[model samples]
Target: MNKHIVIVGGGYVGMYTALRLQRKLGKELRNRSVRITVIDPNSYMTYQPFLPEAAAGNLSPRHVVAPLRRVLPKATILNGMVTKVDHANKKVTFVPGEGEPREIPYDLIVMAAGSISRTLPIPGLTDIGIGFKTVGEAIALRNRVLHQLDVAESTDDVEVRRRALTFVVVGAGFAGVEALAELEDMAKDSTRYYRNIKPSDVRWVLVEATNRVLPEVGPEMGKWTLEQLRERGIEVKLDTRLESATGGHVVLSDGTEFDAETLVWTAGVKPSPVVTEGDLPLDERGRIKTTTQLTVAGTKDAFAAGDLAGVPDVTNPGQYCAPNAQHAVRQAKVLGDNIVRTLHGQQLVEYRHKYVGSVAGLGLHQGVANVYGVKLRGLAAWFMHRTYHLSRVPTLNRKVRVVADWTLALFFKRETVSLGEMEHPRDEFRAAVASNRR
Candidate 1:
């Protein structure tokens, strides 16, 4: 009988784990006979850090994601969502697109399905709030922002113009801050082409519920970031919450009411809900409870990592590993090695990594960084942000393309064209049919 390994999700953890396992167990396990399979809805892994830049036209969106099939040629990549995990039966059930649910048995399982955006039941949010997690969402937002400008320029109605020119972003973490900065930068640059619109005509607001923004870099740096964003004409409303956003009308808890056609939701993320279907022990936050070795607690032959796993941070006793790319990448390596070690009857290694600080891009030629106890701001921090993420982006092919995009940007202007029609391709046809009937 051959041993089979099934890895779920093709994000950082899943992709890296499969890659490491293939390399480690290749020649050594030829006679032993082992097979590896990876399951994910999409066959590509998105480099999330560059998503904001992609949305802002700083980097090509295509370059921010790597095809999983190309990266894991040795592993069987299946396009599907694992719906259920039957730990007792040693089989997992998955439902691929438009197909009946299927089941497969495996000797070892690695649960790496990452997280989904945490959402609240806010009015109109479900209909209007745009997510900033995946490549598709980022590109959609870019098109939307550009389209809004077009609407603002062409409209004669003041109300329509005001709504179109107003942009609201929630949250102030890396995702929110980078997205706010990049889009604001793009919108400001794009205003040059809109005869009726200027940078001042656009209302850019960043609402953070916390007392400060960019808290990942610490308090002092966060305060500095607040000043930088405010100086750029973005209204920073801290200690505020969005009460409602209905029909383009925004009602903030801080007694602010406005209308904006663009509403971005980058608040935070919760672990993937798939883990709850299984009988595995989970933390209070719905993440898989894992030992420091990255193995599922009280379960043999089961492992978990990435945003979905609550692996204790051995370096920071009471805290679990933060759900960030840095921790996920490093944890994936340890998780893969431990899996191989477990199979070979070797000692399992515990995951322990120190905090390396944080870096964020405020816009082109602007950023903030706190690495190794040293804080950098302005152009230097911005440069550090690009340099760090560029090196971290997986695959040589993607790295080259991203670099080329930046190099080209130095000599050329950012692309300002918006393809809003992409969102509703059938609108014109529907209108044409209705007119003929009339």
Candidate 2:
């Protein structure tokens, strides 16, 4: 019987691991001795770092995602979710697109289901706040922000205009900071097109529970980021929490209350609930418990990585690996190699890598970075930010397209057109037919 290697989640781990396997085990794959299958809800893997640029209309959404089918031609790609893992019986229960659930037996399993946005139970959050995770959310946020500008420009009522112009973003992490900076820059540039809407009419606010922003970049850089944001007229409230957002009215813990049409939530993320559905051993945070070699604890034929796995950080000693693209990509390589070694009955290597640094884009031609204990800011850091991510964004085709976008942007102006109507394309047609019948 041929060996079946099943990989869950087609994000960085699933895609990269399969890619490495196909390369390393070319002979086994060609002889049909070992088969690989990958299951994921999305057909393409989203490069999450570029989401802020996509939200700001800086990069095309299509170019930021790499289709798994094209990238993993040899591996079987199943567009679905792994609902249950019966690891004891070596079977996995999966739900295909609009189909009945089925059980798949595998000789080896790789769990990398990734994670989802970690939200709070704040009032009206579910209805009003938008997350900055998927590409769809990024596109929706861009349209929503632009639409608010339109509403503010057309409305003469003071209260309505104020609400339309005020935009509040919860959290001061990388996602929130980048999203706020990029959108604010776009809105500032867009004001020239609206005669009645000046740049001063816009109100941008950043709320962080902690005393600083971008904690990954160290305290000095965090303080510098705060200064940069405040210099641009954005209100930065530290050690503040969002009490509630009932009816798009924001109430902060610092006794600040305001009405805003836009509320962006980028607090953090939690492991995918799929982790707990299985018989796998999980840490306190509901992440799969794994050895330093990327193999799940107490399991001989199972492996896990990425945001959903609690892999120890050898460099940090007492801490688990930070859930970031940098670690995910590197861990995937090690996990892939370890799987191959296990097949050949070889010793597995431990995962150990020192922390490098952090880089962030702060709108067009502006950024902040701290690499290898050296700090950088302004245009140089911005260029470094783009250069680094461009090298790490997967395929060459996507890299070229992204570069093309940046190239064209140099000659032309930033596009601020909103296609919010695309969200409900059939509404107009439905209304037209009803009117004609009447």
Error of 2 at 295 (Å): 0.7
The digit string of per-residue lDDT tens for model 2 on 309-363 reads 9999999888999999999999999999999998988999999878899999999
**TM-score per candidate, chains pooled:** 0.97, 0.98
lDDT of 2 at 369: 95
What lDDT tens digits, residue by residue, belong to model 1 across residues 1-438?
A: 478899988999999999899789886446558788899999899999999999999899889999998998778888988988998888899888777888989999999999999988889886568999999899999999999898888889999999898899999999999999999999999999978888999989999998999989999899999999999999999999999998888999999998888889999999898899887789898899999999999998999999999999898889999899999899889988998998888999999899899999999999999999999999999999999999999889999999999999999999999987887899999999999999
Clash counts for all predictions? 0, 0
lDDT of 2: 0.93
> CA lDDT of 62 in candidate 1?
87
Off by over 4 Å in 2: none
The residue pairs that clash in candidate 1, if any, are none
Q: Against the true structure, candidate 1 has what lDDT?
A: 0.92
* Reference-based lDDT, each prediction: 0.92, 0.93
